[model samples]
Target: MRSSYLQTDLLSEFDRLQQQVASLFGGFPSSIRSDRYGSFPKLNVGTTDDAIEIVAFVPGVKSDQIDVSIDKGLLTISGERQALFANEESDDARRYAQERYAGSFRRTIELPANANPEQVTARCSNGCLMVTVAKHEASKPRAITVQ
Candidate 1:
């Protein structure tokens, strides 16, 4: 019986430690993820020969609501997602699960050294914000002929 009790205690301690580690990294795992979980509007960054592209998936947000800016090698995206049921009858309604994040959110990304902050452009369509930053002329690759 004493051995069984020790085993139980050890199991509980292990479970607690697991919880702590998970929280330290981020909240409970979910289908949706981000650079920092719970941060609105997940984005993907990629580079091409002449430009860097950033696409932010911001569903349920309007193009007018979003604000994109670049300053000192940092690109920032800010916007708001209004609640879906803000005007609905809430007194009698109950929420079973709430996963969608609403309200204002902002995400800042550091531009690469080759990025040309002066040549940034952004457009929003189909619930996604696409930003393209041209690469500096000095950093662009060039083909050299064999001597």
Candidate 2:
């Protein structure tokens, strides 16, 4: 009877370890199934002497479908990239997976205190969205002569 009890306990421990492994990786199938698609767009932000530059990799999305705005030092990039599957009414789900972040995306980036939001400019080229936020005059570096 003790040997049977030990075997049962060992099995339970193995099951628990399997669950821990799955959760450590990326959770279970149920968790993945409940996850949502079309997350907010990602960006690469940097700065220069004259302007703060932000580039977002958003391929397969047209320039007309995107909207860029700035409010209270927050720059927002929003867009939608429709799926390009050829099937008009095919019943097959997972048609090309549609994983290119389709159906709307929004990303807000905080601008520095010296950012000149009024002078911001945005352009999309070659599947990348580039935004230039001009820096305030006071923020630009200047040489000073020491007395």
| Candidate models: Cα lDDT each | 0.87, 0.82
Query: Residue-wise lDDT of candidate 1 within 22-47, one digit each (tens)?
Result: 89977565554323444788889999
User: Model 2, 98: alpha-carbon shift in Å?
Assistant: 6.0
Cα lDDT, model 1, residue 116: 94
What's model 1's TM-score?
0.77
Clashing pairs in 2: none
Per lDDT, the best of the predicted structures is 1
Residue-level lDDT of model 2, residues 1-147, one tens digit each, is: 999999999999999999999888775545543434434466799999999999998888889999999999899899777767645335665555433445668889899999998898999999999999999999999999999
Q: How far is candidate 2 from the true structure (C-alpha RMSD, Å)?
A: 6.7
Best by TM-score: 1
Alpha-carbon runs more than 4 Å astray in model 1: 1-17, 30-37, 87-93
- Superposition TM-score, candidate 2 onto the true structure: 0.68
- lDDT score, candidate 1, position 2: 100
